[model samples]
Target: MFSGEEQGKVQIYTGCGKGKSTAAFGLAMRAAGCGGRVFIIQFQKARRCGEHESAERLGINLAQCPQGRGSGPCTSPCPLLTAARDILKEGGADLLILDEIMAAMRHGCLSLTEALSLLETRPAKTELVMTGRGAPQELVERADLVTEMKKIKHYYDEGLPARRGIEF
Candidate 1:
């Protein structure tokens, strides 16, 4: 496994909101903009409708879960956990984002302890960010930064579908 700097920070983007992953990806892009290597692991989100393409366009390394839109809790295997561990192990990136991981774990697609253990073991100096809804308390406790997106207002309530560059 790669060894990172002595210390850095861990962040979590949670709560019922639309921009969790987008925020984390923004941070990744910011780092990459400065020539920092970035690695992203998107769990339980296989549709290419999100920021995946934009993040990739920034030249960040990305590993997406094996499941797709129709795939859910009963999906064969949750490769995201393993892939995330691998991403941390192969460290060198300034930032690593694990998007939509919490919901997947809450659905029994992943063991919370396993995910937490992996989250704790990344090389030093690597900034890590995890995004999803309903993040466990334990994960939240360990995070140095947390952003909760409250759903006070949204166009989705009006029977409107997600729009490009907005909801997706």
Candidate 2:
């Protein structure tokens, strides 16, 4: 929506390895650098993470809906899902990042059907970005660009925890 002829594309990042959300956030930052407004909605997260911290500093519109840890699948009408739906309907930003949304769908916190439906209704000029592992085939087909981060090796495999500012 930054330019008159700019057509927003749908991008998806998914895989077993890390950096899905990170990549999306990086794109958001790049868009912001170009004077584009960015809106990020994080799902199925309960605690404050590095992304949220960075978003605060960058002054991006970041909404986090933390679904508390539980043994069973998440409840219907999840707060995160609702927030995503609202954002899609409202169309408030040039770049919209739905971080970890695929995970929410896979975890049963959100319905894939509804998610796709809402996605169809998003504003034409809003670039859509989705992140998380196990993305549905339908979504993969719908996305204009898709990246999968395969984990051939990782430091976490060697008992290294996620570090702040590096992995959050």
All models: lDDT? 0.78, 0.81
TM-score quality measure for candidate 2: 0.90
Q: How many steric clashes does model 1 contain? A: 2
Best by lDDT: 2
Least well predicted 10-residue stretch by lDDT in candidate 1 = 68-77
Give the per-residue lDDT digits (tens) of candidate 2, residues 53-159: 87778878887765543323565777766776777788777898988887677677778897798679878888999998888999999999999999988998899
RMSD of 1: 2.9
Tell me how far the alpha carbon of residue 142 in candidate 2 is from the true structure, in angstroms, after superposition: 0.7
